[model samples]
Target: MLLLLIPGVGLAIAVGILFGWRWVFAPILGWAMLTWLLGSLRALGKDAKPPGAPADDVVATPVGTDQRTLFWCEECGTEVLLLVRGTNRAPSHCGQRMHERTEILN
Candidate 1:
């Protein structure tokens, strides 16, 4: 999709020049700008930034607000809380141990 942008603009400009009509540049430039903005938005969503200190205060809750368990991998320093279903094997990270994470009720 990124590769297509160049040819799209080039073709638009070429047709405009060949036909001796400069008005075609408006739509072509508009389309190019739209695609550029779309690409930027997509790139922004792809890169996930690490959470700051506020993440520690997050409480994981499922639909209906049932009392769900939270288990996180102690190996990772920024491990996220997990919701427990049935009794299953504990999660791990980087060959390190996993521990249950609890939140203090404020």
Candidate 2:
């Protein structure tokens, strides 16, 4: 991803050199509009969502009253101990659902 920024920075520099800071908004606006147009077109595509797209939105294992579990994020090691039961939805962290750990650690 960092490599992707090199071309963007080069373009910005070229635009700044040729048009000056006062005209920088023109290229920025054009780039934004182009990105938006491409995004809109992608949204209209027939295969915009492949077969497993719905699975991404599916919640993890359901939480229940008898389950004394800790919702743990493997990404950042963030833990949330379920104290009171509410919705069965498992807590999410770092853009992914946390795993359930039934064994309470000391």
Candidate 3:
């Protein structure tokens, strides 16, 4: 997997084998620092969002008493019904958040 190249256990093992155990950490830490720097720069240059990530603008609000609410996942269209609670923490489904859609209950 591509994750094996992420300068973790594999690198540690290779460094420990090829060099000495003491020298192993030198490349590991160097790899970590280099990856962190490069990752930051790559993130700064990105315009497209990673898939299935939650929206940053969403904020949870408390639900009203004597009412019920429906929440739906925008990504997967999964729906949930809940009695109004003191506070609302929107539900999650399929790795995405479910948001409330207001409609008259009467």
Tell me the tens digit of each residue's lDDT in model 2 across 1-106: 9999999788778988997965677767898999999998886784345665543443344455354678899999999987754555677799887887886334
Cα deviation in Å at residue 65, candidate 1?
Answer: 5.0
Best by TM-score: 3
Clashes (N, CA, C under 3 Å) per candidate: 0, 0, 0
Give the better candidate number (2 or 3) by lDDT: 2
Total clashes in model 3, counting residue pairs 3 or more apart in sequence or in different chains: 0
TM match of model 1 to true structure: 0.28
Query: In candidate 1, what are the lDDT values of residues 2-50, reduced to their tens digit?
Result: 7998997787778888885566767768989999999998877764345
Please rank every candidate by lDDT, starting with the best.
2, 3, 1
Model 2 lDDT, full chain set: 0.73
Residue runs of model 2 more than 4 Å from their true location after superposition: 1-67, 104-106
What TM-score fits each model? 0.28, 0.35, 0.37
Clashing pairs in 2: none
User: Which of the numbered candidates is closest to the native, going by highest lDDT?
Assistant: 2
- The alpha-carbon deviation from the true structure for residue 30 of candidate 1, after best TM-score superposition, in angstroms, is 74
Q: Compute the lDDT for candidate 3.
A: 0.71
Residue-level lDDT tens digits of model 3 in 1-106: 6686686777778878988887877766898999999998897667445789664653333555444578898887888876534344577698766888765655
* Candidate 2 RMSD to the real structure: 9.7
